[model samples]
Target: MDIYINKIHYPINNLGAGTRLGIWFQGCPIRCSGCVNRDTWEAGEEYRLDYEEFIRALLSFENLDSADGVTITGGEPFAQPRALLELAGFLRKRIKGDILVYSGYAYDELKKKYPDILKSIDVLISEPFIESAGDRLLWRGSDNQKIRLLSKKASAVYGRGIDRAEWKGRRMQFSIVGDSLYMIGIPGRGDMEKLYEVMKKRGIDFEHA
Candidate 1:
């Protein structure tokens, strides 16, 4: 099997429960309006990764031991159900941490089509980002979105909600990968615009990915 990816990062602290591996899959059909990750909407051969090779790389990742879990996001991880399940199953067998996923599909939609994927994941943050709803709480852009702790592991780690206003759940983390700069984490309403202005001041066009 093979997979497509937008980017991958490690020690991501805000996307899920703790320091974790974040894999941003390539291609999303939801295309939520005002999405900050327009860069991930297109699926190109440039983003392809062999499933076996990807697992090898992950197993050998330098921070694998320290990572609290693995998060699959971007381009809607469920878009590639077969590959996603394979990846998740491999990780649970070879690594020692829970698995999380984000998807533009609602929980009911996902449950109907990809029950196996749900079983493979410990937590799921579901629904397309609702720009009008704002990123105020639950690490969601809209009130319609809900975070489901699908497994006992997730319940143990994130069963209780963290105080939203002061918590790091709504924050973004930046990293430089190869020649491109990447940002991970949820973006509040109008946050992308502010980021664009800041980057523009530095002569950066600010590619939205």
Candidate 2:
């Protein structure tokens, strides 16, 4: 539960309807090329907060109505999988919102190596950023990255596979408004305008507003 930092409105975390609490853990190992948070690449550089203290801070945000759920991001969340798993378990028992995690490791690899860790996460965004595949619209840096759904029991009972999407190297972004989807952060203003026209021509329900 010891978290690094929290942000109120974090566009860099995920696409969703509610306010997000972005927790940047204190370490990372990949040293990804052109990392946005280069400072996090080094471990043991930042001061650590006790687990209970971190949880207290997160709960404080609930009183302020400023956070919907916790987004556990890091130098690399999986780097400290046990600590994260424990934290997520505690949150699931007390909090009502979903848990989202971002990691440079692949989902399948994590599943094989640490299924217990995967069990605690609702959504896992995986894959390292490949500079060649970088696009402005994707959540992470590369086309190889994916948003994986990890509720195995639900998937098993529903008989429907977890939702997964691949980035096709398009400069398109997405936002969620109470389950409604909106595309944001398209590369150019002119291109976005043209895209709106094309969507209209194709009868796609889209608007710039």
Candidate 3:
């Protein structure tokens, strides 16, 4: 039940609706270009906390009623699937809210590699971030990413209309050159201009380094 964390933020507004407990786990295999949390990509170089203590701190939320759910983000959660499975199992037995996980690993890979962990999660946001394919979407960074509900009942309702093929044809690539990040997937200059316009309209900060 031990977990390594980058940090914790209560009442995360941008990630999802309602208040969420954001647990940023450490360690990731995918060293994605333009990765925002580059510091968290290492395999094993961070502090760890006991499972019981981590859950205890999460439960200590003062406004439990307003808390929506726990978001298990990471360098990559599936990298330590056993720990995740244990935590999710414990939480499922004790809590009423949902469990959301973010991983650079795609859904298909997760299903094939660790179906047990998949079974324990309610929602999975999968796919590696392609800086070139970046879009002003709700939760995903690139068009290739997807949101899958692993639970059948939840999938029937919450997972409707989410398909990966819709974005497969889009030309996008992530590249890092001399400590600078750049995306080069727009169909044309006009498309790039339009995307910038949309980003501005939506108030998304796309100029991060």
Q: Top TM-score: which candidate number?
A: 1
Cα-lDDT of candidate 2: 0.60
Error of 2 at 78 (Å): 0.8
lDDT by residue (tens digit), candidate 3, 1-209: 57876556665644433466677778888988767666567755455777778777877876544567767887788877878888789767765567788889877788899888888878888899887884645566677777787776445534566543233334544456566554422232245567778889999656642
Q: Which regions of candidate 2 are displaced past 4 Å?
A: 1-17, 63-66, 136-138, 152-209
Best by lDDT: 1
RMSD (Cα, Å) for all candidates, in order, is 2.2, 9.6, 8.3
- What candidate 1 gets wrong by more than 4 Å, as runs, is 160-169, 202-209
Worst 10 contiguous positions by lDDT, candidate 2: 157-166
lDDT of 1 by residue, 1-209 (tens): 78998877888888776789889999998999888888898889999989888877777789877789988898888888899999888877765677888899988988999998899888888888887774566556666677788888888887656324333446778898788878777777777788789889999885455
Give the local distance difference test score of model 1. 0.81
lDDT of each: 0.81, 0.60, 0.68
Best-to-worst order by lDDT is 1, 3, 2
How close is every model to the real structure, measured as TM-score?
0.91, 0.64, 0.71
Q: After TM-score superposition, what is the CA distance of residue 2 in candidate 3 from its true location, in Å?
A: 3.0
Ranking by TM-score: 1, 3, 2
Clashing pairs in 3: 1-51
Model 1 worst lDDT run, 10 consecutive residues: 160-169
Between candidates 1 and 2, the one scoring higher on lDDT is 1
